[model samples]
Target chain A: MAMKIGEGKFKENVNKNMEDTFMRGAVAGAQERLRTRRLDAAEELGNWEEWRSHGEEIRKHVLDNLDYYLHELAENLQKRGGHVFFAETADEATGYIREVVNANGGKKILKAKSMVTEEISLNQVLEQEGCKVIETDLGEYILQLDEHDPPSHIVAPALHKNKEQIRDVFSDKLDYKMTSKPEELALHARETLRQEFLTADIGITGCNFAIAESGSVGLVTNEGNAGLVSDLPKTQIAVMGMERIVPTFEEFEVLVGLLTRSAVGQKLTSYITALTGPREEGDADGPEEFHLVIVDNGRSKILGTEFQSVLQCIRCAACINVCPVYRHIGGHSYNSIYPGPIGAVLTPLLGGYDDFKDLPYASTLCAACTDACPVKIPLHELLHKHRQVIVEREGRAPISEKLAMKAFGLGAASNPMYAAGSKMAAAMMKPFTKNDRISSGPGPLKAWTEIREFPAPNKERFRDWFKQHEKGGGEQ
Target chain B: MKVTLFITCIVDMFQADVGKATVEVLERLGCDIKFPMGQVCCGQPAYNSGYVEESKDAMKKMITTFENAEIIVTPSGSCATMFKEYQRIFHNDPVWRPRAERLAVKTYELTEFIVHVLGVENIGAKLNGVATYHPSCHMTRLLGVKDAPMTLLQNVEGLRFEPLPNAHNCCGFGGTFSVKMGNISEQMVDEKVDSAEQTGADFLIGADGGCLMNIGGRIERRGKPIRVMHIAEVLNSR
Candidate 1:
């Protein structure tokens, strides 16, 4: 429910984000860096396409047998003394967590950049119940300090913010005096969060991939905050989307390998901690109680549907990084924690077509996202499918567009109708034509010519000229 | 070699020069070119805009239009991609699926047809200009024709080909999207023009009409002094 962020129509958000030069500049720069790094990392791996295929195979296999893996994961975790809670809805997931918090008198909670927790609005729920939740990841910590500005991207949440903005946020919120240098800002945040990491009663995190064989949850992060989150607190909660499970550590290794390289171009992040159950017998360091909450807010329904491939996503934002639309509009335009190409496809499925219908059409169907997907999600196809549903099944398309398309279908299917239309185009457009182009005109030309000049309809159609050339003995 | 031309709706109505050039280039390559008068739109605009069922009629019409050709060629990579996509579009229809498949295999973008089918690397065309090429999204990524245009472009005797910076990015001409999301498309196309400008190429050469129209239109509107040429026209240049 909380997956949808900000308060506006998609267009309104896009218009606002387009106007944010600071954010646009930051997004464009990050996209280039991340894109280059990802490509370099993929190339260094040698046979990246093969690796992508292997990754896709593992994800597809796991998704196909998700129920079996989920059951195995839960039973194995239970055997290892880990409490497993399967929540069917966002409300149920948060309600169970709130109960867990109240039972343990868990007032201070430190979270380690969990997107599922954000999806469930866990922080606001716990905050209302008097729990002071602190975000430990640097980007997340910055956003938390900035009075909970919703995350624009999944992996790099604060990618929309520049260092100057971070410094401003830190100064305004934390009463810190510091320059906009990244090192200084990071050190300030680390100093601020170290106390919370030690003192918080509960630690929360999102699972990168859960292993069904050993019932271990893998958390990948460069910040080492996830390690601290899973190890420091007495009560540890790992919330995962139901589809984030693999058959074993072997599959886990394959996916996590793709995740890191595709995500931030790291061979192995500073932290790739895999935790199974609570603290075991004679364990040197671990949580006293570990809870794995498997959430299926909308995933189970999509399992057998045409959209099942979407659940194979590892949440690496490589698709976001290469998306030209995402580059222009930035992440916030999506109005979801999951922004960019993946977000455009996944958000509508998780959220419905009502508010999210526009998300599918937001894409140019460029297929960059599909090519960049480590698991080969066919993101552009999925986006097109959403449009099909909107126009064909949902009947949500506008009356004008529907009528226009109806006419298009008639004209396009019949050659005589088309020939007539093309023959009539020049004469009909003559009033609007000047200097061989329609710079500005009426109807559809109005939207197009606003930004670019459209060529006036050719007075002599190509087929007509071809016939003339044919009769003139192939002469130019 | 015989080639039936699916001169797409845009080329037939708007950029007739591209169509004319395609015919000339193919004819020079010893191809007996046939322009099917029955061919119309590729159903991409309606199909991409999400009218799958409504677009099928146009698709079927196209399939039948080019059913008897030895090979199908088009100036636009995007429309060729749409032609290739027809097989999948009619996947569930027993009657049309095979018919669509027959059309899909024989279809080729003009440059692809010139370089691959005709087995000719260059047309020996000469044009005096520094130029850059925009690999339109559907042409490069969807149809998977990455090398043919560049192969042909690299051979043009008098042209200096500078690689477009961030050239792989979409020029934001997603049919109705150009109008539907004009604000965002404006930013995207502007960046594309900026990249093409950065190439210091007087001529911005491209393979797809949709993309060229979008980028070329923007260039012309902004009076950026960059001339946009379709690869067919570029190949036909002397």
Candidate 2:
């Protein structure tokens, strides 16, 4: 019900996910497809690097003047006859949303895919108040029907579910007999969701970027569910992270371009909805009352810090698409609503290191995330920063690791110690060495040797050989 | 050109043959090579694991060791990138920052030095075998030395180069990550080995010692019969 999805430890979650060949296969296939498409889209856009810089500049500018933009956005939204609430914590955000639902006597709410709401656990809170909450995005809908399965991926919530798995979930929950074809599954979900859209008393959506100049919330979707969720219900609520704001339409255009391309390799998604405030003066069907909930929930604390660059992220999942670790471990292994590289960096900041310390260490500092990032968050570097904090400030690293690292520092920094260590390494490892490889190594080598052979230490170190050869003992 | 070698600790101890090949290749190319005895580990294992202060001690040692070199070259891309990282590590210290920057500017990965500085691609080395190259992640992405190794490999006479599938993926050798998260690392290296096997290449060539050790160890354990060689060794082969 919370942002943190599973109860298992990070290792247990990874081991569990590693054993799920079905989920692993699905994730691998999706990663390959998305990675290729993202590359193609970047190439097609031409000057992707320039675009990335432009997007980074815009994001950095907005964050630099975030207070001004947030104030302007709220004032404009209020002028357009919308209620605006600033929730500092998850409980506050969900409580305010609950009050609105209770005041309106809302029984059933139709919701588009909104990660901020997921972060606040709004659905669980509303459902506890005896409201029927339905997820309208096809991915979310399938996940919802399967008994509140937390989204494995940020972009594609049900990415862990294959078509056959979806068919199974539908058959068990919805009593629908359908083949394992995407078209059929989508059509069934559409037919089912269409009824919920027509009958739901309220609609809730997540804002991609709130345009400050016009007080308009932008939503990008390929399925057009967000448009329906905002338009069909009489009372509409748009929830967004406090950091998700832009100064004007010009900045909004730039960010949206980066988001669509980096997230899904699209020039523009099928639907781009900008809802200013309720119906305005129009006669068309739209919400009469609109509310904007700006949820801080630990984001504002990240500002003016080493992690300020993390807020510049557009939730593209571009980093995740190329992450080699994510390819093996999958999204569920991250154990959060948000998963992969962004989640690894964010979950710790939002949830604290007690639950997410291992997340930072989950990476190899490959910098693939940094390279793929549209706004250039320097994600791998941020991951390293988390490690530094854990060791120096948090003092949460294992005592053994700390001692080992301290010894390493002494040995490596001093030439004599390094020379002695390298010299002794071969003789010390000789007992386990056979056929130029250590089959069963000692201490740290145990972990290495468990999965693969560790190369036996060279008895004659490279420097030794170099010294001998340079003296004309063998060559020349 | 006078070149100072930063033979990474991994190559110096575990893969001495890689270091030898590197030295022979560079010497044959008409360069006076020197090894700074004061140089030791790059401190990446500790630095990446979050001991920044402790790792800086080793980094400072490296900066001091190679302080007088006209050019510093390393057989491993990961270690060379670590030299570049020293500037950021000492960013707050004016004295160390400038010294680290100077060291960084002159440091080059082996293939990068060969193709860019020496202006030589084909070294006239010949080896007859089907091989796939694993572009180490740090070298390709962070150091931006994507084409240098390929350029040199392409010119290696009698060597049949097969493009490694999913070549952009890291081989699960994140130094300590290979041991710390061994379970997940196993799955990753397994995928890399499977992909290399799919290419039907008899040899797996890599630029970084860490990656070669990871993949090479796996090949030996699985008894896959695919030999692993460093790019330097492949280039020096005759």
Candidate 3:
């Protein structure tokens, strides 16, 4: 129910996720489909690289002057009669929202898919206050209906579930008989959510990007649920990570272009609603009261550090879509609402090493996520930075690994040590070698050998063979 | 052209045949190759494992080892990519930074050197078999050597090449990752092998030794008929 999903340990989570053949199939299928679609969309949008660069530049600029833009945004929002709250922590953000809901005597709350709210565990907090919180986004609605299944992915909250799984969840919870076809399942969810939209006293949505110039919060969605969440409710609360800000509409337009194309391979989502302040007089349909809660929750700590670039993320999930590790392990393995590459990097920073130490090491340093990032966050490098921190500063790495690395460093750095080690490797490994392979190895080799045969160390090392050939003592 | 061979530690200690094939192929291409005896590991194994300070010593040793070469070449794309990484690793040290940068600029993977430097795609090599190439992640994605191997492979006479499905994915041979995250690594390598088998190729070819070792080891264990060959071995074949 919190940012850290299940109670299982990191390894246990991964092992469990690995065994779920159904989830694995669903994740693999989605990855292949999403990866190809992203490529096609990028190809369609000529000069995608330039757009990415522009997106990167805009984010970097905003981050560099985040204080300035935050002030400007707050001022403009206040000028247009919108209450703004700067929450430095998750507790503060959730507490502020609860106060507002209680003040309004709100019993029912309608919500769009908002990761920040999930990160803060707002729904649970509200429910404990005897308030009924209903998720209106199709994915979030399914998850909410199924006794609060934590989101597996950022964009597709219910990505781990197949249509069949959704149908079962809907049938069991809502007493609706429906086929596993997507249209039927979606219609069933839509019909149920429409009633909540009309009746809810308050609505909560996550901001995709807040435009500083006009003090408008932008929401990009395929289901058009965010528009209803904002327009229908009397008091609408938009929660955002403080870093999700653009300096102006120009930058907002550039980022939105990158976000849609990168997230779901769409040129544009079905709806991109930008609501500035509560509403002007004579407005057709809009929230009478609007509140923007900018939640830091340890983000500001990353501002001046080596990982500041991570703040440039547009919540696109392009990195998640392309990550090979995520493809096999699935999103639940990450054990966070924000899964995949971004989650691996951000979770430890927000949640600390006690719970999330293994997330950084979860990668193979393949840089696939880095390549896929719309804003070019250099994700793999950041992951490595986390490793460096864990090893050097935190001292969280295992003692055995530390000892092995020390020996490795000494041997690799010294020419004599390396030569001697190389020469002695074959003899040392001879006991385990059989038919040019070690089917079962010892020490570190055990892990590798468990899955595949390890090559027997060559008795005649390449250097020796090359030396013999140079003297004409061996055949070429 | 004179090329100093940085036969990576993997080739020197484990897969010596890959190194031999690389030398023969380069020599046949009219290259005067020099073996840098002082060369050691590229420091990647330590660097990637988060032992940055410990790895720098090895990196500095490598930079000095190939200091005088006109061009340094290696059989392993991942190692060559590590050579390029030396610059970033030493960015803080003023003296070693420039040296690392110089070392990176002249270093090339064997196939990259052959196709890009020598301007030769086909060396008239012949091998009769259906083969699929696994573009190792570090080599193709980091070093940006995507086209060179394919350029040469397309020209190998009598060799029918089938593209490996989901070729862009990592083979789970992320050095220490194979050992540390063995469970996840198994799944990844298994998927890679499945894709390679799906191509119905008789041989699996790869530019990096680490990838070949992982995938090849799995194929051997599974008792699959597919043979794994280094790109160097394939190019050297007659």
Candidate 4:
């Protein structure tokens, strides 16, 4: 419910998540299922790489010409009698959304799954205004009922919770007895939310891709809640990050293909709903009054910068699913709603480094996120970029680390320094050596020694061995 | 073929056997091995930690060290990818960029060199045991050397290779990331070790030393009997 759910100290969060054996089992199972489904779907697509590349290209093209398309999108939406509001900050976006709700005299609001809304803390704002906001997405709804537990994943928000946890939450909150089977739980939620969907005054959803050509907004979901929310409500509001747009429907189709494949590993999700403007005559579904909220928040600053590639994210969370770090600690450890690789880069940018500085360093520079990314965001590089910014611009890097890296650069770049360092390493580690491995180490090595034995630096450096052999100083 | 061996710092010091095995394996495949005396650590340690200016010195040193070698091969996939990254690091230095590009053109991860460059899939090595391979993130994702190791491993006589669960996830050995963010790193490597053990592998194999060190160390701490071996060592096994 809060932006900083698992945002405590990273270690504490991991320890907590690790202790929850039930949650870990749930996460591991979900990951295995999703990973398999994704691969099968991609294989079915025949040219999955080409599709990924096309998706990346379209996203790049859009980010490159974002301003031009944004203006066009805004103007077109305004022409269709839809109100287009661009909020430059999170508070501004929340204030605008709240003002709209208050003006409409709306109290009960049903919401579709929208990460951007979460990023801006929109629900709390609406709550503060004495309005009830209900989440229609089953995962988010379960999280909401459990005393506003933070979403552990972007796509599968409640991935860390098992069916039993859900059953407990439902029983405690709704006072309904149900088995922990997924079918029974789904049936319970469906029965409960069906009425809220019908009676809701306003529907809020996140935009998957905003088509600039026709001034249309798109939402992709496995569950049909996003579509129902947009259709059944009298007043509809769609919140989107500015960069989540495509130049045309052709580009939209390309990205949508990539999103489904990369995120869920499917050719397409069950629903790919597109809504342009308010309902026209003869339209059986869709809201009568449409509001388009294009959120800049911190996106405009990322444009034309080294970190610009980050804006190309489609929020499919494929990168998160594949990340090894995310696999163990889960999403909440990121402390931001956008956990994982994409979250590591984007969250600190939006929320600032003070709260999210450590997020960037959470990666091992493994490049798994980059490879899995459908938009080719170069996520690992962006993480490195964050480290650079933290060190150079923010001046937040520790003095010891700075000094150590300075020494590393010097030693590694010069043969003499490297030789000297290598020569001394054996002696430097002399205190820890026993049977060629250090069971316990000092300083930085302590972390490593905590989990595994550290190999004591070898007494005979390879260069020394090689030098004697090259000069024929030793027999072959 | 003359192959220059970029013995990654870890292999040069902590795990010299991996480097030695790499050399013998390539030599057995009928390639001449050259150890450039001027070679040092790849700039990865500094670069990944955000010390660009510091890392560039080593980058420049590496460009010069293996500039003229006919083909550069390294025991570690991540370090080989570091050679490939030299061009990107030197994109602004016209002098180094072309030289870096030339180096990248010839650099290959050991198994990748054996399979893709040398055209040898089966090394005729025999290791009678069940094993699981951890696909190091840098090797598989960054260097894009996905199937070469598996291709070679499958052909090893008398060897049963189990696919590691969550094989693609990192073992949390991001150089200093292991030390800098120790807690999270431990958790990550723990999960990786668990996945490998889940495969019921007698030995856990990997192409990169950093990941091996992390996972192997944890397995030792936990007193897991699983043996950890480098892919080069496995390939060179006779």
Give TM per candidate.
Answer: 0.99, 0.99, 0.99, 0.95
Q: For candidate 3, write residues B1-238 as lDDT tens digits.
A: 9989999999999999998998889889998879978989989988998899989889989999999999999998899999999898889899999999999999999999998899998889999999999998898889989999989998999999898999999998888999999999999999999999999999999999999999999999999999999999999999
Fraction of true interface contacts that also occur in model 3:
0.77
Q: Is the docking of candidate 2 incorrect, acceptable, medium or high quality?
A: high
* Residue B191 displacement (Å), model 2: 0.6
* lDDT by residue for model 1 (B1-238), tens: 8889998988898898998999888888788988777888989999999999889899988898899999999988899999999989889999999999988899998888877877999789999989998998998899999999989988898899888999889999999999999999999999999999988998999988888899999999999989999998888889
> Taking the tens digit of each residue's C-alpha lDDT, what string does model 1 give over A242-348?
99988888888889889989998878788889999899889999999999999999988888998899998999999999999999888889988889989988888
Q: lDDT of candidate 4 vs native? A: 0.86
Tens digit of per-residue lDDT, candidate 2, span B1-238: 8999999999999998899999999999998999978889999999999999989899999999999999999998899999999999999999999999999999999999999999998999898989899999999998999999989998988889888888898899898999999998999899999999999998899999999999999999999979999998998888
Angstrom error at residue A80, model 4: 2.3
Candidate 4 wrong stretches, greater than 4 Å: A471-476, B122-124
Candidate 3 collision pairs: none
Chain B TM-score (model 1 vs. true structure): 0.98
What is the DockQ of the complex in model 2? 0.90
Clashing pairs in 4: A7-A335, A38-A265, A452-B217
Task: State in Å the error of residue B118, model 2.
Answer: 0.8
